[model samples]
Target: MELYRSHVLVCAGAGCISSDCQAVKKSLLDSINRLKLDKEVKVVETGCMGPCDQGPVMVVYPEGVFYRRLKPADAVEIAEEHLLKGRVVKHLIYQTPETGSAALTFEQIDFFNKQTRIALRNTGIINPESVEEYIARNGYQALGRVLSKMTPEEVIDLVKKSGLRGRGGAGFPTGLKWEFSARAQGKPKYVVCNADEGDPGAFMDRSILEGDPHSVLEAMAICGYATGAGQGYVYVRAEYPLAVQRLNLAIRKAREYGLLGENIFGTGFGFDVEIRVGAGAFVCGEETALLASIEGRRGEPRPKPPFPAQGGLWGKPTVINNVETWANIPPIILNGADWFAGIGTEKSKGTKVFALAGKVNNTGLVEVPMGTTLREIIFDIGGGIPNGKKFKAAQTGGPSGGCIPAKHLDVPVDYESLTELGAIMGSGGLIIMDEDTCMVDLARFFVEFVQDESCGKCSPCRIGTRRMLEILDRITKGRGRDGDIELLEELGRGIKAGALCGLGQTAPNPVLSTIRHFREEYEAHIYQHRCPAGVCKALTVYVIDEEKCTGCGRCAVVCPAGAVSGVKKQPHHIDPEKCLKCGTCMEKCKFQAIHTL
Candidate 1:
């Protein structure tokens, strides 16, 4: 075995790859070779580190010195200073958001210290493509334990006792779902991992697949053993090319090692998995629709009576769980059920992985205990709103979720509590909004997303979402009716009650929840004919303050609409009709003179 004195772990997750981590990696390697330190130093490509915004990130082990936001030049300097000379690169270290002080190691950064990583344990810690590294971290130990010592019934009981509800949006009891498939009379049962993570701004599952693909593979084999099946399938979306590639590699590696193929551990039991790539349909995130897509049919949700556990995948009894849900399985098996259950609240157990984005200082992946409050996630973990802006609301659960107002910041983020707030924990996409965000426009944006993604199989989701979207569109365009709010509420309620499948039922969440919390904003849009956040171009006008404006022609020079008119050193006036309300003038002005109303 080749032993290296130091290992450099570079973040090769999708975000970092787009940020040119490849170039940085090459430069680091070149510098290391140039310095004749290639024997002592090793570079390893790993999956996402939670803090994605600071991409092209790398950490030097032994010392664990963290470096962020690196260019090729920065990589070379780190290779020279830190790798060769044993000096830490101070300027490239992550600066604490609260204080401008540098956090040297991953542990020193609050973004990492605050997170409880279960689904993300191996991510950014090891090379995802290397099954050897995964094995070194006790990766397949759970599956081996289950096959050798525990019975199928015992496995189910352990999971049930763990209090692990499905992490795939619907908080269904995973053990109960497995038990249902076990008890159901069928031939050649199946285990399916739902990798169709379609939520906007969600990459939790993708990161897991990219980082620790074997965790998911091992869990599926366990599920197959528990459910009396020999075959499993991973239905991943086509959008995640890297995730799919890693998954295929993991499967191949598992098969080679007899971890996936027949007669594992000489126990006369065998399980294997295959990958099925989806065509990036958001509706496919729903289990029934996902199953349909796996069957090579048009993805559409069917009414439940015969759920997936009873009759799924070519009319055979099958157990299906999403990527995050499956990733939690190995941990529950290795660690005791009580250990898992003890971590979270009574109903919602274990930690949740959230793709934290929008308006926050630390925008990346965050995993915390189930009962962690919004304030803790936003303030302590997320570093609050950017540029000293006040937090207005947080949109959880994607299009199926409702907006949580500032008053609910202290609310414990559990399945029941979020549902109580009209937001379902739909796969952990938390978008923070600052005070400057227009609620009406935000609601409209989400509603439009839902409407566009609707499969149109059901009229309630199809026509009803369209109606609500049209009303929201009119409201944002300064042509809202007196009863538009009431009409939206009515339509939203009707869709929730009448729409088929979970998608349609939860489609009106954004509009309804925004109305429930920010009714005043809606009133301002409808009655006052204005957008309080000045986001709606039709309802907004940019004005220059005479007291602040120096009549610098900077605004006039940049205005594509040519609306600004004034002499030098004089306050400028804007023709509202000619003004595009693009906010380009405000961004261009050296003095903070332009104000939006």
Candidate 2:
């Protein structure tokens, strides 16, 4: 084996890649080769390191020095100073959000320390494209042990004992779902990994698939073994090309290593997996719709009861589990069910992976135990809201979920708890909000997303969500009626009850949850024709605070519209008629003169 004295691990996740992580990789390699240190130093591209706010991130192994926000030009200095001479790059070190102190180790930062990383176990720690790295980390051991020692029924029983419900938002018991498929009388029973994650701002599954594709592949093979299915399909979205590529590569490598494609540690058990690309439709996230898409049909959902377990995928019994749910199976089998069950709350077991985004200081992926409070995730792990902005609310579960207000910040984030508070754990998309965000506009945003994504198969979802969006649009535009609030509630409830699939059923959640928690905001929009957050443009106007203005002319330079008239070093005046309500003046003013009202 080739051993290097120093290893430079560069982040190659989508976010970092967009931030020119590839250029960082190239520069490090070129510098290493140029410096004659190629034999002693190696550079490898790893998956996400979670602190996406500081992207183009790289970690030096053995020493574990973390460098953040590197430009292409910064790479030579990093290689020459750190990799060549073993001296740290002081300028590139991560700045601690609170104290402004530089942090050397990424794990020591609160953003990484608070995360558990079960599904994302090997991500950022190993080369994802290398099967050898996966094997060294105890990758396919669970499959070998299950095939050689445990029976199919035993595997199912172990998973049942683990108390792991599906992480794809339904919270269905995974073992029970597998058992149902195992017992159902059908030929060609199939296993499907639902990677068509269409939820806006939800990338938990995508990160797992891109970072640790082997885990999902191994877990799916385990599911195939336990359920007596020989064939598997990973229905991933075409939009996630990186995830698809990694998954494809992992499958090929697993086949070469004899870990997949008919067999097992010489145990004669046969199983294999294939990848099916989705057409980027949100409705394909539904189980039946996903199955239909895999079968080369339109991605439309059918009413259940003759559920997927009984009749799925070409009219044969099929077991469908989401990517994250499948990723947890191997660990549950290896660690024993009781150990897994003991970590989370009474009802919801194991950890959840959330795409922590929007108005958060540390915007990235986070995996915490089920019962961890929202306050910990929002404040402690997320480094609180950015720029000292007061926390307003959090939106969980993507378009299919709801907004949780400040009153529920202390609520424990579990399946039942979030549901009791009027939010579902739908694919674990947590978008934080600050005092500047408008709750009514927030509801309208999600409603518009659902309205556009609705398959139009059912009347309640197709027409109801559209009407809801229309009402929210009117309210935000200062054309709301006195009865609009009650109308929204009535319509939201009807959509939830009358919809055909989970997508439609949960489409009204954001509106309902926001109204339930911040009804006063909705009332303000309807009755007073005002947006408390001053975010709704039709109801918002920018004015200069005479006491604070210094007439810097920065606001005048930035305003797309010529709304501000001021001389240098004097108080400014804002022409309300010319102001576009873009808040450009507020952002540009250093004196805190511009106020949105």
Give per-residue CA lDDT, model 2, range 1-597, as digits (tens). 889998888989888998999988898889989999999998888887777888999999888888999987789999899988889999998887767887778667888888887888888878889998988889999998999899999999999989999999999999999999999998899999999998888888888888889999999889889988999999999999999999899999999989898766788888899999999999999999999999999999999989999999999999999999998988888899988899889989899999999998888888999999999998889888888899999998998898888888999999999999889999889999999999999899989989999999999999999999999999999999988989999999999899999999999999999999999998888888788999899998788998888778889999899988989989888898998889988987888888877
| Model 1 alpha-carbon drift over 4 Å, by segment | none
Off by over 4 Å in 2: 550-562, 565-572
Per-candidate TM vs. native?
0.99, 0.97
Question: Poorest 10 consecutive residues of model 1 by lDDT?
Answer: 380-389
Question: Model 1 — TM-score against the truth?
Answer: 0.99
Report the C-alpha displacement of residue 241, candidate 2, in angstroms: 0.9
Total clashing residue pairs per candidate? 0, 0
> What is the C-alpha RMSD, rounded to one decimal, of candidate 1?
1.0
Q: List the residue pairs that clash in candidate 2.
A: none
